[model samples]
Target: MSLCYCNSQKSFKDCCEPYIKGLKNAPTAEALMRSRYSAYATHQADYLVATTHLSQRALYPKEDILLWATSNQWQKLEVLKSTPTTVEFKAYYLDQNKIPQIHHEFSTFVQEEGIWYYVDGEYR
Candidate 1:
């Protein structure tokens, strides 16, 4: 059983994969944030794009996203805070140079028609 990348103590299939694969929708902003981290870890650019708010899509051109997503070796993810529409998390990973790094961000999300979408984030 492949464990999920989001540090959720759940199988990939039982955790974020369902959201990434469109089999289900994330119920909260924190869930969406975790799933997005899982998408980045797994190099699922399409899922990342699909879960992004339409207005924010243009900021992340596919090539740039693919480049970043493919270059990282994701290690750990920790959610620091969450609200109805925002979540803060820290993700640890290795860069293309194999240097360890941390990504800490406060993310905003929105729900439209019962589907949650990532809006933007502020890096820490």
Candidate 2:
């Protein structure tokens, strides 16, 4: 089975490839949010850090992030709403013990040098 999102018609790679590779800027806050979801699903921590605003990136520890990613089976991502600087969504997944869980949040983003970078989020 293949996993894809964002109505991009392309696979996650082809769709969000540039963002993941630091080759292109995310056009909207929602785009950044979706790419972050894909990053979490793939356990691409370096990409995560790269896309996060430097001021807030310190909130997460790399080792703990890797552990969390390894312990979860990411299922799907849903974007409920978004604006130029914020996005609200829910990501569903299963834990290491196979317990299903949902992480819902309203995430904020900022544009720097024409690139969108995640700032922080309010979990809901």
Candidate 3:
């Protein structure tokens, strides 16, 4: 089995697939963050949009999200820190021009009714 795109050292089916597939909810902010990274790697734009907080959904249209996800060659994810409501991480990828790039962000998340949704981030 292939390893998860999140570099979780576990098989995709075991690590993030269930969340991406909508079969399960991510239990923590960190888990949601890791699964979101995997969604980018797998080009699952719907998952990304669905997991975004509703108030911020308009800020990230599905088309834009799809383009961003498909334009990159996702490499790996490095989670720097995780708290109850935040996750700081670096996502490495090759951009459209095939240049290596890093998207670093300290992301915020909110849980409503036991479901975690991405709110926004402070890019660094």
Which candidate's TM-score is highest? 3
Residues 72-116, model 3: lDDT tens digits: 999999999999999999999999999999999999999999999
lDDT against the true structure, per candidate, is 0.92, 0.81, 0.98
TM-scores of the candidates are: 0.96, 0.89, 0.99
Colliding residue pairs in candidate 1: none
| Per-residue lDDT value at 124 in model 1 | 99
Give the Å shift of residue 3 in candidate 2.
3.9
Lowest lDDT 10-residue stretch of candidate 1: 61-70
Candidate 1's C-alpha runs over 4 A off are: none
Residue pairs of candidate 2 with colliding backbone atoms = none
Ranking of models by TM-score: 3, 1, 2
Across 1-124, the per-residue lDDT of candidate 1 in tens digits comes to 9988999899989999999999999998888989999999888899989899999999998778888999889899999999999998999999989999999998999999999999999999
* Prediction RMSDs, each to the true structure: 0.8, 1.9, 0.5
